[model samples]
Target: MTPSAMNMTKEQKEQQDIDDWLPITSSRKAKWWYSAFHNVTALVGAGVLSLPYAMSELGWGPGVAAMILSWVITLYTLWQMVEMHECVPGKRFDRYHELGQHAFGQKLGLWIVVPQQLIVEVGVCIVYMVTGGKSLKKFHDVVAPADAAPIRTSYFIVIFGSAHLLLSQLPNFNSITVVSLAAAVMSLSYSTIAWVASLEHRRHGGSSHVVDYSMTASTSAGRTFNFLSALGDVAFAYAGHNVVLEIQATIPSTPGKPSKKPMWLGVMVAYLVVAVCYLPVAFVGYYVFGNAVDDNILITLEKPRWLIAAANMFVVVHVIGSYQIYAMPVFDMLETFLVKKLRFHPGWPLRLIARSLYVVFTMIVGIAIPFFGGLLGFFGGFAFAPTTYFLPCIMWLIIMKPKKFGFSWCTNWICIIIGVLLSLLAPIGGLRSIIINAKTYKFFS
Candidate 1:
């Protein structure tokens, strides 16, 4: 060992090892805008499409409150993640599992995050496959020959999955920044379209005259269950916390300088964009359609055929971009295990075959289930509540070990309690919703 290395403490040596493993290459490093693009693409996804439906369930006051609460809680956890990364003194825990190991002890860290991260991310890809296929089919129905046999959504799933497979081969996160930027723009594009369409529909008196603005649910049981489900939906909407560290890793840190500034800047800009995109769609769509808003607000729009079609097209594109951004972490994790643990050579052949097989696997699941709302509820409640809410608070408490009964201590404990409640109740509500809707469920329906 080198002289300085030989003299290092155990913690210092361990930190050095991690730093060596995660060297930020010039090509892989990015600027703040690139980070912002990645965060926006990761955060604002197909979940945003459900905001209006969530509003329908919770009404204006409660729905907006839920959305804002989710946003603040998620943003706070994101900051916690950044703080935890700096906890090891000189070492950087650039991956989620690393942070887990640091806070929860060695093997427990990987066990804690790997399965849930896979569920949230792989689940998202499956949702993307289903949503993309449905959007494509809708677009086709609009423009295709009326006499032609209606194409099944599975065909479009394969077509889009193939495209995703191609994009997945782009090697690393920095390489996909352009695609993510396009996705951010597409998110804005489709959201703007939905908002404007809702306004016009309201002005022109297109649908039912009455708009329900009451905070009461349809039934008392519904108020409890539906509100829980709405909270889960809002949680799902902000589920990008799980991947924030991975996104932060792409931005190069200057020597001896705090990286949190650029990281916070990117996060702030991205969340600002998220708030702008989410509020209008939720409010306007709910105002226009009230309790009748469809799970995907775009589906509720009937007139302005071209504009709605354009918006759906944007959804497909944005999800395509989103699928890759989210899946890249899963791909990295799998490939790392294969190469480091199994001794597989780090080469293009392995990457292409492994990633392609993974895509096919998600696509198959998408075809078999093809139930969008159920999967959202399941993943949102079962996976996201813990990953996005529970774990971050726990990690901070563990790492920081703040003074007992202090503000940080109380706040973290409160968050932990909230997260636990969400984990237990949200999934029950989500599963119930899935079961109630199961009788009508069909493959690709």
Candidate 2:
């Protein structure tokens, strides 16, 4: 045998250590806390901070509806994760592209992942950039009001995002874990901070729209349109499921341990944490602002100079963590298409070239999409909704191959239908808005 095969490799030693640590058990499920925290990490990305502002635009009733619809989309994501695990056993996360291809087809996976990688992931980066920019501006303005400007905000995002990408390429990717943990703390802290701020705002008779459940007993297609349109926003909030694939390679294969539970636990934890974090923020924000809340909550928070710094710090940390997640797919795609497919070698020169391209692309998109809130709305409504909702549902139908279609199958179909209807609703609303005021709202122009 070769020397390498005769000795313990790094991967082998790591696996042995994990096996010793976790041991092997017959349990098919993770403990509640494990499931809870893993999902929470994934959910607390920069998007949660922007949510209250997004919902305020539609009124409290529509905003809450948006939150619930987003959760519905999240439920489908949860179902997909469960189904993927059941079908593929220990390797569901590794074989996400395979699952996509198997469940749908090769072409479908390509379509799904391309936009997922390019638009969804990159768009998310843009959100973080804009959000971070705003947060930094807010922080700076309290101390030096004259120094804040859109250009300065733009510069900060560029520096911040580039630093993350550069740092991620270092040995062991150690900073990723640090950034992730910090992000969790910051997000939770922000939730607490925003809640306190909202309460204080309300105590002083703050006129923000917090309650607007004025639903009419009318089913006119025109009136119900905005509620339907908000489905895309929900889908955008639920788009973190694929994140498991990015970190799946890091999972240790313990000899005695049940393979899938640890990973599944991670996913569920991310979900709960994010859901809890988002809910209160949305509720409190709507309650405080009512109809007048800024599309971004940071704009509406009425805190002292010190508390504002804390909130801004939280936003910055969240953005740092987000860049790591977004970079994974982009790096993978470049490695596949450039180095392997196109026969270019992987080295420092190539890495720098790829990194520069990503920086440029991210900056252009961030600047081009002015008004962070509107960008989220447009992307959520048009891009995220269709990709998350329609594609997944159709793929599940093909993958499950139900003989008589039980309750689970029926529910899956219903979700799919809802997603499709919801995806169509956004553009329909956009079209209607254009028709009403073509000169004013120039979708064509």
Candidate 3:
């Protein structure tokens, strides 16, 4: 007898075929909690890195409010996932690029997706490179205490970042899922610890200055501008949900294509989990440091000696995970265009050239923008605004078949309106600060 006929019951043979057809590590194969955790981890990743800096403009109230707004947006995106499953069921669209094409049609889809993908890829890489440099610098300060040049900080970042980016090209969900979970643990552990430790600073009675909301109230323009600019930070914090949709096609099906309810549930739990983790940190960091919190909280805290090295490693680990997550889609896109479509084989020569170029690119950008806080703010505010806020609502209205207008629609429209306002706000706020006050907007500073 053939292997399939001899060893298996009819039901067993059928089930094996179904499992074989399903992609390995697809979203369907992921435990519901795993998907939830994957998304929640990414959501918190951006916010935690950003909260220390956000304290400046919004203070505790507004900064915390801003992150809360991120959660609200998360809720909206979760609702979109429900609608997405309803509209684009089964394997109708395997990637976000395909979703964009289906929603907006080919011409308009390319316009939106190409730039969005590029921005996400480049922004993620830049963040990793910069974060790596900072962590290395921290490490050098601890180990050597005083070194003339400290191993040419930029050189160290280029070397390490290049190696990691190359590793990222070999796509595997199991590896990434593990990393995502690990990132979540580190992010939550440190953020929670940091939040608790911050209480110590507050109990010691740090200086306090209540922001005068009325100061900007005289002209609604400035206050309007401040709130709008703050929205970018909020959008950036909430921007990772779209990533889930890209990975949704990977799940295994028992009988037929799986129901989207599990996926939607995972997305929802992830958002709520992230909200729980981030809100407290934003609240405490603002409350503890007040208006003086550094853009990257790692810079502000003076932790125990033992924890210092761990803290440096924590940042490094976070960036490593982030780089892998962000780079996957970019590599996927390149593969689609080059190997899949163009029929260019994936050869050793091609891999060698790509690795060399990636290294050079990482170094140049890393050295130029040594600071990432402002760069993230700008991208979160401007580049990602359309995708996070504007694109989904527009897609829902124009593409998805409508049954009844629901609360989901209501929330997404609010996101759309907020996103538009922020896109305008980022440039206006940046320019106003510059032209009026002669202050320059710094990318990393």
Candidate 4:
């Protein structure tokens, strides 16, 4: 052992060992493209399938504007987080809460960021659990015989969660780089398939084929709620900021050359890929199916059997990786608490039990309340808006202290204002939709 290691107290040595073994801090060998792959996996996920349904609620003008505005705003917010990762030389904010602690104060920052970050990350895994289930059911139905017996979505959800029982044990983010890369590719692929299939549906149209652009809701209250809910959906689509700092932490930071340069480069490329995946599926899918579009565009498209079936399988695989991407951070938090606060021994047994229980918990909840669209709207607005849209902006303004009324000041305020509005208004619609669905929904079916 080194002289310093020999001199270290038992507690300090144990803490250092934990730091070396923990997932986020364990690796610093990631490349810029790792950022691209992880960002793409996190960004272009289950939210894309719902964009068409969100558009149907929003109609053309607002839908197009919301999509464009969110793209630009989120890209800016992501840049802010990247820059702040190593803002203090010789120190790094390796997790969202760490950055929050720096900005808000130790206790207050953890309070401000942890709950919101947890909601975003844990909420996503729950939603993706539902998504994976739905996607698997869709794939099976497409390939099975016309007379084949139907399967409960709950069963598929359990099956999907089962994958995580194995995968959740993976050590950290860098460990899943290959899976994340494949998911990035799959997200782009399935998104392309959704739009291409949608376009083909339009081109082979009959003279009588109708594509109505009118709002589908019959009541004024319903229309208002749907519009608010659509805003949440758009907000949900740009949800990579919660993990930007963690992803950047994987890339080594040095005094002379900060990690932000390479991280920023990766995100620029990642955002372009996001636009390419998001826009066409949303616009074209809604344009083709109009008010009749299913919340999942893949559910709306039934033709070209082999292709659609393949797309659904891709969704299952993509979410499998996306689930892990979000889950690793949560795992970090859980393990840290257990080891540091609860004083549990830091070893494989603690990790296995903690992670497995978490997987089961989300699985049961997903099966019990599998309202995909409503959950997206609710969680999207409530948690996602703050973290993805405005939390980082708020931190930037606070820490950087840009001049009052200047361009930076004005822009950050604009994003915060919009984010606050979305957070306040959108959940009303989402909760209402859930309640209405629940009146008839039988749990665990």
Candidate 5:
């Protein structure tokens, strides 16, 4: 029950009923670990596997700097978001757009925040759809007999998407906690497997990997494009900020203690786990494979047949959870619109049709063109960079209105400059990479 259970105003009662029905607000009993694994599940995604490839494009200097900077910058912005969640007493901004509506005003905030947030959420779902499918294919190829007829990658993708048909119908954030926890554990497992496997491969005479550290692209233009694309890959990793508010909404908040305390504690633990999973995978995977590292590190380490198979399966599970984490917010937005704006009744039929349709749409899109690296870069720079890195800072400045030119203003401005640059440059490389992949990639292949 809500804190206002004692109240009995007609409109308040009605609003409480809607809140009870909605996905995010329906549960508020999630503990700190819920925040932990949810953040871990959201933060450390399959994108960590691509860090080596991103590092390769960036080379030693920019690569190292980009990795460290993104972790710090996004962490700072994340703290800002957690603080702002209950900044106004007695009210909680349970969703990202709600916070935006408060900071930018109702109408303007929707326009400013919804499109980018939608792109991030929808884009992540599509990317994970592709990832889940690809990992399945990779696993099948490794364990199955070599002479067996090769399955089309498209078929494996459909099989992977089929899982979501049922999973999408899960009621809300609370319902998926077990799934998220499993996914978070699997994420850590596979990331460890990726780096450890990379090291083992290196120990065994490099297993045909090219060990040179020089930029893979020969031409000046090609290297520049890759560098820009790599920025997107790194940006894609620290994307938990996208769903932080929604995750916090699940935790019970009260006047004396507020939700931010437990939420921030969980975030710190999550970030620590992130550093453990990310830094080793990026540095070790790149150290072993150099410029020739594949976009997904697990794909590169194909030796130790059984372990490699297990890692791929882990990836499949992890991305499934990641896909749901990003999708829940979108579901809330859609259902809220249907019930409130369109006057549709809130019921199981609405959730089934709306959520299923959204999942199927992402599945179709993922099946049609699963350019994994390109999607990461494109979505990361275009939307991830903005939402994860600077959108919160922008909101904080607007809402808090700190003294001009003070340390607070300076820090936010610096973050904004970096984030804005990423948004402008990253998509160019990502789009180019997609076009290049398309030339050789038969549709639905």
Candidate 6:
């Protein structure tokens, strides 16, 4: 230890050691675009793929409205997180759980924020497994001979799941930025391809004879349920809020300005890119396929072998990259718990075994519960509502302590109320849909 470090207390010395160890490299930190790419990559994966199906449920008018509303609310919550991080005294937090501990008490943060964030990350990996396997199978069927025996999606699930498990072994978040950048480009590429394909389909008379744009469902109860479910889908698409702090931590602080400014600029740029990618896919896919769209819009397109194949390839690659990005948090939390709480040293073999097991666990869950839409709704409502919507509002209210009955107070309360309703109603709607479709449901189908 250095002479100055030798004079420090044990706690300060340990903290200093941790701070020195946590950064992936000491040469240079990430640029603004690097942060943007990471954020955009996280925000624009399986969720964007589901937007057309969500739009089908809500129709054009309500669908567009929900998309816009989700964007605004998510952006506001993201900014709230950034603001909270900026307001902390001394050094900034590098993890979401730390920020939670700072805002709420340690107990609440441990019990609430950590687990919810884990769910968001692990849940997303599960979705990626299902999505990757299904997309791979679809692409295979397209090129395979007509007389070939069918291969179950389960096979592809294991294959891609193994691939993801290997990729999950990357040491830290910064190690995966190149993967994240490639995933971001793939996201944009597939989104653009899907959009152009949809437009082309419409030009080639693929548009539905009957295109319904109604805001309400056939029945009042059904309408309410469907609207909430659709809202859940929209919420899930915007669920990257949980990882904003981690992404921000990857970038070095700019000189002579609050770190929040660069963070905010990166976030805005990411959201703008996300909006560009999301709006066209949701709108164009709905326009072409109408209510007949599949949960993954790419599956609905059948023409131009090379183009569709390329898009599906992009989806698979993007998800592979995304699996690592999302899974890193879970790995970090578990490793931290083992080291800090359980008195285990962080070692390479232990890290590999722990992370590999987590990936396998998620893969098993994905294989078991193959109901893609239902899982999205269930987790989005139960976990993401709190993480993405409710908690941020609550944290801001607690930390900022806005005046009672003032604009900020009322707005936050409104968001909180909406989040509660979504949490309760969205699961009901999602589960109802799952039950209604249960007769035809099959594992690995």
**What is candidate 3's local distance difference test score?**
0.62
Off by over 4 Å in 3: 1-29, 82-86, 146-152, 204-230, 254-259, 347-356, 403-408, 427-445
lDDT of 3 by residue, 1-445 (tens): 7877765777576455433322222234566666665665666664475565565565556666667676776567556654564364444455666678888789889888778767866676776777777776765566564545546667667665766756664544444787777776776666776676677656654435452322232477865554454555556666774565655655444435464666677777776667666777777776666556666666676655446557667767766676666666665565456544676655556544654465457657866665455555566766667777677677776676444557656656777887787776764553443344324534323
| Residue-wise C-alpha lDDT for candidate 4, range 1-445, written one tens digit per residue | 8777676776687888999878889899889999999999999978999999999999999999999999999999999999899888789999999999999999999999999999999999999999999999999999999999999999999999999999998898888999999999999999999999888877776215777889989999999998988888888877888888889999987887789988898899899999999999999899888989998999999888899999999999999999999999999999999988998988889989999999999999999999988898999999999998889999999899999999999999999999899999988888888898899999889
For candidate 2, the per-residue lDDT at 191 reads: 75
RMSD of 6: 2.9
Task: List the candidate numbers ranked by lDDT, top first.
Answer: 4, 5, 1, 6, 3, 2
Model 5, range 322-372, lDDT digits (tens) per residue? 999999999999998998789888899999999989988998899898999
Using lDDT as the measure, name the better of candidate 4 and candidate 6. Answer: 4
Using TM-score as the measure, the top candidate is 4
Per-candidate TM equals 0.91, 0.78, 0.80, 0.98, 0.97, 0.92
Per-residue C-alpha lDDT of model 6 across residues 1-445, encoded as one tens digit per residue: 9876676777686655544443232112667777787788888877888898889888767789888878888888889988877566666766788878878888987777888898888889998898888889888988888898999888888988999767877777677889988998999999999989989988877654666555445788887776667777877888888777777776676446656777788888889989999999999888877777877888898878779988998999899888887887777677766766786755677777888899899888888777777777777787888888778899889889999999989988988888888787777777776676677878655
Worst 10 residues of 3 by lDDT: 18-27
True lDDT of residue 343, candidate 5: 81
lDDT of 6 at 231: 74
Cα lDDT for residue 22, candidate 5: 89
TM-score ranking, best first: 4, 5, 6, 1, 3, 2
lDDT of 1 by residue, 20-59 (tens): 4322221436788887898899999988888898888777
Error at 319, model 5, angstroms: 0.7
For model 4, what is the error of residue 415's alpha carbon versus the real structure, in angstroms, after optimal superposition?
A: 0.6
For model 2, residues 1-445, the per-residue Cα lDDT tens digits are 6787757576586444432322111122334343333345456666666666556545566678768767766656555654554365444434345557666578987766566546766777777766776677677766565554534566666666666556546322222566666767777888778767877878766644355543321456645554443444455666665554445434544446543556666665666666778888878876666555665676677566678677877777766766665555565556556754676755667766776677667766665444554455455666666556655566666776665478667876777777676666665553443344444432311
Off by over 4 Å in 6: 1-28, 212-223
Deviation from native of the Cα of residue 110 in model 3, angstroms: 1.5
Candidate 5: stretches off by over 4 Å: 1-9, 207-210
lDDT of 1 at 140: 78
- Residue 117, model 2: lDDT of 45
